[model samples]
Target: MTGFQNILTLYRENATTLLIVIVFIFTFSNNYICKILPLS
Candidate 1:
């Protein structure tokens, strides 16, 4: 039970970190593209 709980905690922490990185990447890409595109 203890081992299972530890695994779960680690998984949750990693998942959170992954989500944050994904969001950061998405936002950064969008901003970069917008800057490169010429405005009408």
Candidate 2:
């Protein structure tokens, strides 16, 4: 039971990190693409 609880905690931490990485990628991509396009 203790091992299972530890695994759950680890999973939650990793999930939060993954979410942050995903958000960073999305924000970076959008900014890069916008810079490449010309605006009037």
Candidate 3:
């Protein structure tokens, strides 16, 4: 039980970090693409 809880905690923390990184990358790529494309 203790080991399972520890794994769960680590998974939660890593998931949060991964989510933030994904959002950051998505926002960054969106802005980069907008800059490259001509405005309508």
Clashing pairs in 3: none
- Using TM-score as the measure, which candidate wins? 1
Q: Judged by TM-score relative to the true structure, which candidate is superior, 1 or 3?
A: 1
How many clashes show up in model 2?
0
* Candidate 1 residue spans exceeding 4 A from truth: none
Model 2 over residues 1-40: C-alpha lDDT tens digits?
9999999999999999999999999999999889888762
Residue 23 in model 1: lDDT: 100
Residue 36 in model 1: shift from native, Å? 0.9
Cα error, candidate 2, residue 34 (Å):
0.5
TM-score to native of every candidate shown:
0.90, 0.88, 0.89
* CA lDDT of every candidate: 0.97, 0.96, 0.97
Lowest summed lDDT window (length 10), candidate 2: 31-40
lDDT of 3 by residue, 1-29 (tens): 99999999999999999999999999999
- lDDT (Cα, 0-100) at 33 in candidate 3: 91
How badly does each model clash, as a count of residue pairs? 0, 0, 0
